[model samples]
Target chain A: MTVVDIPPPLPVRDRTALHERAPGALSPMLTRLAEERATGVLVREHGTLHLAEGRVVHAESPLAPGLDVLLTARGTLDAAAWPWTDDIPAATHRLLVAGLLPRGALELCRLGALYDAGYFALAPSSTPGRFRYGTTAAAGPPGAVRPLRAVPVTALERETLRRRELLHRIWPDPSADGAPLIRADPVAPPPVTPRQRAVLDRVDGVRTAPQIARELGRPAFHTLVDVRRLAAAGLLVPRNTVPPPPPLPPVTDPDIALLKRLRDALEAL
Target chain B: MPGIDECLLEAMRLPGARGAALVDWTSGLALGTVGEAPGGDHETTAAEAAELARLAAEHGAFSTADDTEVTPPVEDLIVSNRDSYHLLRFVVTSFDATVFLHLWLAREDGNLALARIRLGEMAERLVLG
Candidate 1:
């Protein structure tokens, strides 16, 4: 009896090859199909084209409005757009065969994420058959597009650091407090008012009025008065805890019983 | 190809360059900024650019046929004035962040093609890691 040997996967090789491709050159990412055949997905910064069983599976480009941010921003697609949704893979296969999504609008980032997630999910991990690529795609439930970057996993931590740096450039305060580590200085009081200026200067993130008064060797109550006055003048902001959510009463609609009866009858029918 | 930072500088080197900034799409924050001192604060500019990106992205998703499954990922945004043009180029790197480079240029002195080419190169060089 003759034995048929199955071929190993191609994503690992394809990833290395794609990484080695010249910066400006077109890159093709090869992956193995369930039938043990070679397949590929050509990837670029702005576009992607997928091939299966020696045929084009899909093609996408970002000439105008890109597609990734579109679907997610509108909250239209979730991972359903992944490479192996039940109806989608087949739909895309047919579309590719028929030339529908050729140079089609692909939210490139989403495409990238789907490809990465699908490729990693199927390529000989603990879980198998969960989300197989090269299969029919199905419509997924509504969800948001998770973030996907081009950097490899090895560099993810460093990438996160840099991403945070970039994020801070815009919103210096990522927290709910919306305040920087170093609080803003109070507005300058008139030169004659040393008392107000002293109060303003002591109102840093660190010490409270009591602490400041203790350090200055002054009476706590007098310092508290000054602090309160400055705070009232809109020159200072003290930390405050977030308020709790209000309570809700139980529902007591008079039509509830009637609705329940109607529902029970519909179920019985 | 230079990284996103270098790309903004190259953009600023353009003949009537005004200012530039890079923004994150998710939060609408500027990653970096250049040029426009008198225009406004960087935070304000970044916030405004983010708003534009959000509007454009929403519009694209609404207009798409796959509204059920498709959303527009913004690649670039452009605005023109009597004397200048503002360009926003988005780069979706592997880390799941959407970053955009904002460039402002004088229409009369700027070369659109060169600016675009430079931006593309910069996007490729941007080291998300």
Candidate 2:
């Protein structure tokens, strides 16, 4: 992903001006820009909100999580779900016009994901209550447009959204990508719960199940069983590209204190 | 034939059953709690239970090698201790949120197979808001 700084307090333009001038409209409007074809970032404005798209794909928006990152996080949607189809901008426009999802919701998904993926803060939507388009410019990746045409489109999208929300529940740290892999200080005492203890027995981190068993002096099958139990308890973090975690809320209530205590006790073992 | 409350009540009815609760996983909020927790802190236990669900959901999302993509949305999570077992079963759906039943039972008294079957039956009748 490319990053371009927006000049301080970008002069806001009207929706029609954006629709006619933004890259979102440029392809259709391309026949008209008789000079040099622009190949940078286009930030479209609708009221105060902006939706950004590169020539090949959308980078960020106030509404949607980055589809690629969201899909990666869900793990349910393989990379295949986000195959590169020509004309991503048009496809996005079509998805919006088709009313499959509200434009803002889509933007939230992308924006939320981008935020989790380590991007800039999303500005609140400033688009007028009336539907219209606008434009802005940012640094962008070089590539032709690519649209998403993955299978179980609805399923993929929903799963990714669910995963995104789940990640937000933990910390903002992107390290835990839903893997069964977890890291615990070996020197720490085992947790009180047998389930947690079982998890610790399997944490070699570098090896798969069979290898973990050899190191721990356990049967491969038994090790797998224990590993599955720990995984179910959410004690393991898988290795690989992790999805953005759900946003964790500040622990405010007194009950949260006690709960954290129990959690710590359990995981410590 | 059981309602949401009925489900929890039924889970507690099992031999050696200790306590039960209904949790909404989306927000990790326990909708209701029944029976006494070891510390007699239902509120805290419920909150913790939600955290467990959150963790499980996160692990599921990032573990790409697992068959989660093929496995139907998780219907249940069961954790066993030396003396007891804790079961958290998700009520399956495609809506914006999810609900689950959390049950605690004495290991010596609990029948895992039976409990699973009953939980599955209970999940189908749950009325999610």
Candidate 3:
């Protein structure tokens, strides 16, 4: 096997104060790592961001699915044939060779995943997490992977702030961000935009905004914006009326048809 | 299959181009940016432009009668001020019509018709993975 030179891990910082100083201290930690040109993974409570030469190459969060899931969720890649492995680079190469995804498209999806996951990873509520700078090659979860290009940390921060503001502009309620979507009464349903209608159809009153986004294979932020807009328009069930359900099980065979329908509805919208 | 950076760079090469960005209208995120922003801040400009894009894409009056299925019923929107022109060209992807290429152009040096044509071409070739 060919050996690769891995950079030394940066010393661990307590960062408790940073977390207290701001809701999302991960930005500062990321900024520091970028400034130092550190190359490693910054693990946090929500997810992990892989940094290479001071730039963020990839990010993964439980709140947002990874690129693989996004691709497969959209039926771009066959779920059964997905190559699951710890070796990301090799897997990426294999996918390229197999024509599963074009190089440019893969990169775009990677970037999209980075920002999508970054929104939740750097959320103010994802606090009290530790930061360890070490190569993720040996540390990331079994399926966690890195991207081909490393995006500047500043760009990611700016995009995150923009998304937050966009959602706020649509509706001021943060509760709508995580609440399960339920269609309002048909008798007096507020007029909804096409996209909002598409989202409303998937509102089983059980799946939260994030879960709906995963099912639709769209970015979580996009789903949040739609949900917030729908709530603002009074087209969705009031947040207080619906109690959040227990965590959902992974999408299984029975759900594929539902996901396909969601996908078709989204495309039609 | 040009990346956002390359697409923005190509957009900037247009006549009188002041700034360009690939914005996700749904989330108001700038996938990439190039040149100078109208207000000297790309982030704010992107968000503001997204508001316009959202309005055009969502309002029924702006859509054609025959376009019952397209997410963004309108093809493009142009907002011109005293000195600059803001062009929002919608790009359809595998998913919803949530992304657009925003171009801020100087009125004196910009050619609106040509810019629109070029933006359309770029949008056709532009690929977001």
Candidate with top lDDT is 3
What are the per-residue Cα lDDT tens digits for candidate 3 across B1-129? 465677789999999999998887777777778999888988788878888898999888898878665458788999999999999999866533378889999999999999999998887666533
Sorted into a CAPRI-style docking class, model 3 comes out as: acceptable
Q: How many clashes in each candidate?
A: 30, 46, 1
Instruction: Name the candidate, 1 or 3, with the larger DockQ value.
Output: 3
Task: Give the residue spans of candidate 3 off by over 4 A.
Answer: A1-28, A75-104, A125-127, A136-148, A238-269, B68-70
TM-score of each: 0.32, 0.32, 0.76
Question: Which window of ten consecutive residues has the lowest lDDT sum in model 3 chain A?
Answer: A138-147
- Compared with the true structure, what per-residue lDDT tens digits does model 1 show for residues B41-76? 776677677768756654544344544212234456
In angstroms, the error of model 3 at B126 is 1.4
Every prediction: chain A TM-score: 0.22, 0.25, 0.71
DockQ of 3: 0.36
What tens digits encode model 2's per-residue C-alpha lDDT throughout A1-269?
88998769966757787666543332222222212333333333411122333121233332233444343343423445444454334444444445444332333233323322211111222431221233422212223322221111122223234334444444444343223465543344333233235436556555565455334322232344445544444555456545679899988899989999999999999
Ranking by DockQ: 3, 1, 2
Q: Which candidate achieves the best DockQ against the true structure?
A: 3
Which prediction has more favorable lDDT, 1 or 3? 3
| lDDT of candidate 2 at residue A222, scale 0 to 100 | 30
Q: How many backbone clashes does candidate 1 have?
A: 30
